[model samples]
Target: MRDAVWRHVDGRGAVCVVGDDFEGERQFEQLGVNPFVLRPGEPMAMYHWEADQEDFLVVSGEAVLIIEGEERQLRAWDFVHCPPNTKHVIVGAGTGPCLVIAIGAREHDSLGFTVDEVAKRHGASVEEETNDGGQAYARFPSREPTAYRDGWLPE
Candidate 1:
């Protein structure tokens, strides 16, 4: 397997395995896959919905799924399927690193960010509703490319 590439937002972010190489084609045309590594209380992304279907699998550790204003606890092997326009976000929980595989279809103009009270409580909602990702994460530090380190996963 190729060494994972990382991007950090306030010390937490995803370990991108599929599109790690930035010098060449970095994305798939029909779908996208990303493996996120989050610490306790860290959110994988802002609260949002997409016009295309998206799915998530809790590969290791635990997470809290905030979906449609409800919170659901998730553990390893748990899977979540989100249809078009299903509002959701995942926050790391439990005592260690949470590994989640996020997969989604690639459709044109397919996403929108939202501000939700439930998501705000978990630091996962944008300050204002917008379709632009740059505006949604404007207040936070940029996701700088970084080298992957060991121990993000268990032996």
Candidate 2:
């Protein structure tokens, strides 16, 4: 009975977790791609990467995607394809944390930033907040996190 779930993990990003494939392997599953909230009037740093293999999609909110040295704004329901090793980065432009869902042909080692990984990469202190379900969510403060400039873009 596996289905998509969006239970509140934490308020940090309030990410709505979903699955890539309705029915498939766990490792190959693509979870929601999210980051810290983006406040208006503040521009978060951007990161460009050459992903060995993966693709990204903007399922909701407004995302400013810098792909192949070009910047474009993506609104709700808009989608962008970053082929393997292509340079790309996305920044939230709308009035909330942009919710992104990525589908990959095969799961890559790293799709985006995990809480812990982001903290470690940026050398920031992460605070853990527990939800009603007891799942711990990590939170950190960074006007500009390292993830801003370090992400794997799909070729």
Candidate 3:
């Protein structure tokens, strides 16, 4: 198999991915397992949830786990689990680029959320990510084939 497909979700959680296509052993469609990596200043998503669950693991560097209505500082090896319909977001915490491994079961029916406090504190311009996932991301650049590979390190 080839390398894992990476999508760089910015602070706004705006992802301009054209399609959900990946060829690998793990069936993301059937198993609903999606893996994502987050770097410094980046996050897995704004605040959103689906029917399935999502979990996170800090492989390297540091990150802040924002869940429910609180922020928890996390370092390497830290793990976080989110049950179904749990509103949560993971943001890179410290100076260095944070390496976070996030996994979640894919669910078509999901909704976005807005956390004013988190947005204000994190300097995120987005208030809420509506159900139209790619609507706001229309102006952003298309996904670069290997762009996320640059964030593979803990810089």
Candidate 4:
């Protein structure tokens, strides 16, 4: 399970990691939560939920929060709570790494990803809701380095 964490690099050269997915030798599933840590200047593609509620927190560094097509700069310890079906994305801001902890209600009918011109400009891998993280990463390497072992990224 330690090796399951994967790395993602956006068009702007932002580094992100998938912390844990509670799969393969890991039975400790808690509310279907997943952890993602992104570097500065990287934007999470625009997306929304069909039924689940998504929430976020800044563990370190700062970021820009895009909600319903609007934007707001966030600082460390800041939190974002998205009710069901809210269209949003979080972009890393400032000069260094931005650590964001996000939680989503696992039980849901569907998840939706929207194509935003701004997201495209940021080099988001996925632009449509046809699937979760497919097209956006169609060209990524098959084997990705684990988040824990990536020394170049922030912890």
Better of 1 and 4 by lDDT: 1
Q: Once all C-alphas are superposed, what RMSD does model 2 give against the true structure?
A: 11.8
Kindly report which residue stretches of model 2 are placed more than 4 angstroms away from their true locations once superposed: 1-26, 29-46, 105-155
The alpha-carbon lDDT assigned to residue 104 of candidate 4 equals: 68
Over the stretch 64-85, how does candidate 3's per-residue lDDT look in tens digits? Answer: 7777767789999999999987
Global lDDT of each candidate: 0.84, 0.41, 0.59, 0.60
Give per-model TM-scores: 0.90, 0.44, 0.70, 0.69
Most accurate candidate by TM-score: 1
lDDT of 1 by residue, 1-155 (tens): 23666776763565566753566464677788888888888899889999989999998999999999899999999999999999999999999899899998878557899889998988999988999988987777866677675756656
Q: What's the distance in Å from true for residue 77, model 1?
A: 0.5
Tens digit per residue, CA lDDT, model 2, 1-155: 11223222222232223332224235334433432233222222223333455455655567666565556777767876767656555555666555555554544543232123232232221233222112221232322212221121111
Better-scoring candidate (TM-score), 2 or 4: 4
Query: Using alpha carbons, what is the TM-score of model 2?
Result: 0.44
Clashes of 1: 0
Superior by lDDT: candidate 1 or candidate 3: 1
**Cα RMSD (angstroms) for every candidate in the order listed:** 1.9, 11.8, 4.6, 4.2
Residue 2 of model 3 has an lDDT of: 22
Better of 2 and 3 by TM-score: 3
The parts of candidate 1 lying over 4 Å away from their true place are: 20-25
Superposed model 3: Cα runs more than 4 Å off: 1-5, 9-27, 32-35, 135-142, 147-151
Clashing pairs in 4: 125-136, 126-136
Instruction: Identify the leading candidate in terms of lDDT.
Output: 1
